[model samples]
Target chain A: MSKIIVQGVAQGTVLKTTSPINFLGAVDKKTGVIHDKKYDIFEKSVKDTVLVFPHGIGSSVGAYTIYSLKSNQSAPVAMICQKADLTVASGCALANIPMIVVSNEEFNSIQDGNQITIDTKSEKIFN
Target chain B: MELTSEENAALNGEHGDTLQTAYRILVATGEATNAEKLIPIKWAHLSGVNYNTIGDAGEQFLRELSKDARVKVKATVNPMGIDFDHISEFNHIDDEFIKKQASIRDSYIRMGVEPTFSCTPYDIFDLPEKNTQVSFAESNAAIFANSLGGLKTNKESAFSALASAITGKSPYSDLRKDDITTPMTIRMKMDNPNELDFGMLGFFAGKVGDTSVNISGVSQPNRRSCKALCGGMGTSGTCAKFQFIDSEDEKSEKVDFGKEEMNEVFDELNTAEKGDIITLGSPQLGLEELSDLSKMLKGKSFEKRCLIFCSRAVQEQARTLDYINEIERAGGEILSDCCTCLTPLIDTNETDAVTTNSIKGAYYLNNSTGVNVNLKPLTKIIEDETK
Candidate 1:
């Protein structure tokens, strides 16, 4: 069963990474592109996709960066994580973006470019 | 997470949009962290004040929130782009930067947050009672409060702390919980480590360790050195809440911090053999460091430009103690209400490299500001750069 962190329903292509994100340094706020070369999905745009990652890492400004993405209209339609950290959770809540968490088994089952739907009210994430 | 009737009401938008937003954030954070309920916090020290860090998006966010949100508890802010009192001194800051920075300040003030634009809040402000929960967004302050000041916090983000300030509550999880234990232990193999050495050790520890680190083999470090450790740890990685242990059990996973590890960090940060200018205070120098610097430079003057960053209160207090005068007499510029990290004062085009005693400052200057850093100890900097 998938756990919903933020309440919303959205469908988008999956942009998955095994690496934990630090939104403050990893993502470009204006372009919604992953800038950190260390990550698996480097230089890929996060716009209007399902941002799937392990979790978030980094300092306090990271939350604001996530909000910046939404403000700039470059935000992911929804986010799915194997775990939820404070930075991503707070940002997702503040930005009013849908967020969900899935088990490790389920996380590995999803792949990049897959069309996924996140329905928080129903607590379901399906392709 | 279970919420009280008042919290539920706020979440339901009965208390206005600001409270509704705050409660929603808190509830989400609590649910994610597996916190059973939201606990009231004594204070919140936020860090989104830097215009360079937040840009227009964060400024707009605060501007909108300021219309209705007011801090329920004591809330302190971090440093902005330029020190408003000393605005005319720095040529790098433009009118637009000043205007946006001012807007950010106005928003915080309108929300009833204190204009204490200092990173070392634990140094200047009167601390709350021991074990009291607080929300701190400044990384160094959070680490210092947790490890040394006997206060508890989870090293909150700017948004999380702002939300906590508005609601007077934080999710009781991670470092806030009493049952938390140190997952990694580091044993030092260095002999008589200086402040910079300790900072290197801390930077290494933050990189390798987990949520909490247990460090052994350091005996009673001074205040400035302790601050350096916190600052360096806060700078390099996400590990928080380090404790000094005299001894440890055999079952614990241990890491060693030695000469090789120290050299690796030093080599990584200290890219320049010499620098055009010297900059200090990533955590912002407190009164103790100022006093030490004043004593060190009693009969000497810096051969090159030396910029010292400290809090306004600390700077004023140092002036009263004759420390600021001595530093200024030695050709050091005392920049208050701001530190070296992400400040616009240090222009990379004019100065290709910067010499700094703070490891945290070195990292940010090299990575964010695009300047080569010359990392040195305070004593070495004074010895080599002054005549």
Candidate 2:
């Protein structure tokens, strides 16, 4: 298992999406399902998993969507992105869902359903 | 991130939970962007008000935050989901959606935000000093403040802007740095440029994907044309700012666009065969635009639905000048606060197609609503719809 230091801490099974997620149009706030039909992860629930993606795109309201997910008790346990735009950063912070950015190489090395743990205090991710 | 004593205290929850949360988000954002410190800001403009966009989750967040959080600086809010004054007029919309929209406005007001409810806050508010640091969330307003107003702001998200409003600070990075603000050169030479031509130029620049662009060769542009240009650019791309120069400036690489290129852009953006509904004011119309629109509709009455959206401030001014009455008499409905892009007040299913002069409006309506949008000059929309 490879380990790397990062910004926020969490442990969960990974659910990866190759394409970027736009939470505003791409998410169903009530159910936490990925509603964007264009992506392979469409109809997947983000709840209780390590949601991994390249980054977020589209409306800034995405921050609120993430907050809505958390409020509805349907938020992912953790998130790992190749980069963190303000939308993801702010959203994750507000939702209190741990998030970290990983290098593309490290991100590509992992597969869906792989159990992972992130420790922001220790600044490390253990697989 | 290096934190000042006050910042450290805020992060440590010495100030309050609201400030602590704001500080934590700001610090996290700063870490992501590699910002060294947080800087004080003069103003903060927030977006994410439309219930159709933010939904229930956003409303809960605002409600909770507003209970204990008061803005530290001058802050203005973006448009609500519906026109509050004429709520009864829009009987086509759902009562639940209207209530959500009203709650958004009420929550922001309780948080001490000015009820501007306008995207083009620069139009009504006094201009900030040159190079003044501010925080603005709306893409078009942020671009305009940076490019035209000569103020400094990054394209902020709703949460980040609200954080800045509460804390009176923002992560110092990107547009705040003077060295990175220098733009690359993209020269444009157009013959007899109009508002539509300017919008096309902005669309082309957005397609280029350059953050900072210095454009030359455009003749003196009026405020409305400039607004259209910046609005289109911000909508289509992530450009922070653009500078316009005279035709004689010979120091940079230039791209020249003519009538052919303009027509190509129009073809790409126009998806409607004929417009069933005509909508305007994506960034919310300025007083000048309303005046011109009123004049254009003087002798015309449309059988199809026509909606003109503006801010409460501008709407009041238009009323004082009798422009609202003339537009209404000509069979046009004037809506305030929200526009076609942000709200579902205008049902795409009810109308076969939509038309607008606003490039931003056309793009968002087409993408978000799955509606066919027709891109035309305002004159053409008026002429075709009236006939």
Candidate 3:
């Protein structure tokens, strides 16, 4: 299979999902705690890493979370989105978290454990 | 632009005493967001910032600029006070938090702000009709103004929106509908989830869409539920932030809902199966809600195997009220903003299925974490559990 990658470059700590908590309120910049109390899934701190979500969901403050993460030096190096959003764009621009977007179909080909890379110059993503 | 020379002068800080600070704050905010000129808004809704946050440079700026003007008072709806409840069985009570909202509200009042103290302004506030310029803080409310009532506004911070409200004009940038409403693709089933689920789904969709939406696959919503979806949509995607709902059948009681809100919840209910974990409080919890939860668990203990949810902010507050400790004492875990961004909660070899009321929680867990999700209504869950 031609694993066509949507490559882009970003600076962030590569984070993997271990539990299910909404990404929106998942990470808090002020405290650097990932609050997802109900499920024993995952609750770890994320800072200065590449945080990629197969997709986006959460409060608009999710953008502010990125800003708070960055301003407090608690944010990822960059973010990769299956789709781009107003909050993410504004936050990325405001927080300077380099971002790369890929298509859903393209993302499906990339596995969880696979090491994927993005290059901002060409706005391309690859594994 | 409606400012007379005197109003402009006041905006420029010609006003005396308190009005001076308000004026300068507005000017700086307008510049930051790229407002060409200031316009006088008919109303303003603020988030009633914390006393500590008000001490920042933004606060000083507001004080210096809002001199002589009276601020032409209006109503406001800020976030709930830090601690307003004295007693709750779901958790303990914190008497100390009582003054938190007071301090924040007092400072805003001193600087000329009204504190309606709610997340949903369309519920109570006298919002101007389509194209009527308005200014409001609270992320959820900002999208509500644009997507629900057709009024115009941009997302202003604690101070910026207040400034715009006082000035009666927003930056005039993306607040316009033509600039905000864009189309996007979203694949999610929403069925009769409760109001909380409605809001969560909107958040997830926003995250997935990553901008404002012109989407397919959902339908019909109650007005309030639509606002919840709009609020969530504003979080990740659109400048305006919205979703259109689809419905096959609804009673007269259901007509108030928007197509987007109904479609999502109905889809979830129809599809969700048993044995899923339900989580709540993704955007954080309210002080009053904390009190309610304390009562919910006064005598009963959580089914150790079930899943629950809450925000990091609420966790901190709970600690103060002993709610967190109590929840722990009762048999549940309280975590800070933990998940997706951190180490790995999903990809790890963990549980089988997760259930939640927060639409954002369900969407992210299923999409990002690869977890099976069960979403339900908060009210129904409470009724079932309590009964």
Q: What share of the true interface contacts does each candidate keep?
A: 0.66, 0.48, 0.09
lDDT of 2 at B71: 92
- How accurate locally is residue B4 in candidate 2, as Cα lDDT from 0 to 100? 95
How displaced is residue B346 in candidate 3, in Å?
24
In order of lDDT, best first, we have 1, 2, 3
Q: Which stretches of candidate 2 lie over 4 Å from their true place?
A: A1-7, A11-22, A31-54, A73-76, A104-117, A125-127, B181-210, B245-269
Local error of candidate 3 at A127, Å? 29
Tens digit of lDDT per residue, candidate 2, span B257-339?
66676777787778887778888887788899889988998888877888888888888989999999988998888888887
Over 4 Å off, model 3 = A1-127, B1-34, B48-73, B82-96, B177-197, B208-211, B235-239, B243-356, B360-375, B379-383
B215-242 per-residue lDDT for model 1 (tens digits): 9999999988899999888766667799
Model 3: per-residue lDDT, tens digit, A28-124? Answer: 5554456655333246566655565643343433444555666666666666656443345444544555665556666455554455555666556
| Model 1, position B251: C-alpha lDDT score | 74
Listed per candidate, the RMSD to the true structure in angstroms reads 2.0, 3.6, 11.8
TM match of model 1 to true structure: 0.94
Q: Which model scores highest in DockQ?
A: 1
Candidate 3 per-residue lDDT, tens place, B1-387, comes to 233576577756566544444455554344333445666577776643432222222233334344433346464644432323312422322343334435444555565655444455565545676787777665667777776777766655554555455555455545543555344544445446446656756655654443354444455665535654664555444345554544322221222234575565446433356433444444334444555566666665655333233434445556798766655554544433222211132332454555555554454455435566665655555555432
